[model samples]
Target: MTGLRKSPRRLRIGSERGSASVEVAVIAPALIALLGLMIAFGRVTDADAAVDAAAHAAARAASLERDATGAQARARAAAEDSLHGDGVTCQSTDVVVDTSSYMLDVGQAATVTATISCTARLSDIALPGLPGAKTLTATFTSPIDTYRGRQ
Candidate 1:
């Protein structure tokens, strides 16, 4: 006698065949888009850090000057130099220096502020209604020595 009666056969892989490939095909575009976004974000973050460093260098350079005219020139040059050294190429770069503190009376606390704006080109990251470039701005302030003689 047979130990057990025969049971109805069930097919486990009949309908689900190639489902993994289908799922991957459906999700491939989304995954690619996510990766692209991450790469773009990383580039923007690096540019932001470079711009901040440029601003800081500009502020420091301007703070060492004794006159507003020299400070402005130095700040602009320093900002450009720093950005270039950091391998950040900007399509358009602007440097602004606030020299109001330079006019303060001697022995008073003085501060110089430098603001840098940079528009960097993106790598084929074009979207509808979105520009292919990103503008990053940074501002830094540095204290001028109170004991230093002013012009």
Candidate 2:
């Protein structure tokens, strides 16, 4: 008994052997969640940027020749290039060009919509718990009438 009492520190240390795991269990999830959210948000922002770039490109193209198909195509290419140059898929089969305003109108902006998905990986344990991945869509509008070209 005396020896055991003398080694009280050792016993205390031994009791907490799995305590690291406990601490990790409590904290790891929150950390993982934060990280996942950040990654997801990053992808969302990137997608938005791509859409904006696509819209800008399309509007510029439309302003030149009033060709809706070409404008949409340019926008899609630009957006795809934004995402590692993998090529973007336009959300709609038809690239709607609101030529109603024409170049003479104050607001001759056209809308382009695209969807992009990104894969984010986490710890193996967290993978099943977290959403596998998310597909994000973004719409961009640019004013064709306001386009001056070559600033």
Candidate 3:
């Protein structure tokens, strides 16, 4: 019995030492990249919503105007104000108002269309392979008062 005494199973402490650190080192970059991607996606989504709202506002503003020139100017201002109020900072912003409806005679059904384009900056995210900026565009149409006079 003494001669057959079982040898104790040896635990290899050194083999597992620093393993957690190694694992973290290997996985940290991937986790960081994933988080960055999520942030980028969120930013893009928010910008899209902002642009859409801007277009809607612009179209509504334009539809309320009685003349083509006034409609264009009001639409641009409304779009810009909407985007700014939404905290969307764009590298370049373009607002196009189609006011052909204003030429329609009074009591005729017509609509105004507004298109807004914003170049949102993504470089702040600092994600590799991500575009420095993305252009978000939205278009909206609003019906003008059928009984209202138009020029």
Q: Which candidate do you rate higher for TM-score, 1 or 2?
A: 1
lDDT of each: 0.89, 0.49, 0.94
Candidate 2 TM-score to native: 0.53
| Superposed Cα deviation of residue 106, candidate 1 (Å) | 2.1
TM-score for each candidate, following the candidate numbering: 0.81, 0.53, 0.92
Error of 1 at 111 (Å): 1.4
List all candidate RMSDs to the true structure: 3.8, 6.5, 2.7
Q: After superposition, how far is residue 143 of candidate 2 from its true place, in Å?
A: 6.1
Q: In angstroms, how far off is 50's CA in candidate 1?
A: 1.2
Collision pairs in model 2: none
Best by TM-score: 3
- lDDT string, candidate 3, 1-151, tens digits: 8667644543466457899999999999999999999999999999999999999999999999989999999999999999999999999999999998888889888999999999999999998999999999999999999998888
Clashing pairs in 1: none
Q: How many backbone clashes are present in model 3?
A: 0
lDDT of 2 by residue, 30-139 (tens): 88878877765665566556555554554445445454555546654554455444243433322334433342433434332333333322333344455644444434
Write the candidate numbers in order of decreasing lDDT: 3, 1, 2
Query: Which model scores highest in lDDT?
Result: 3
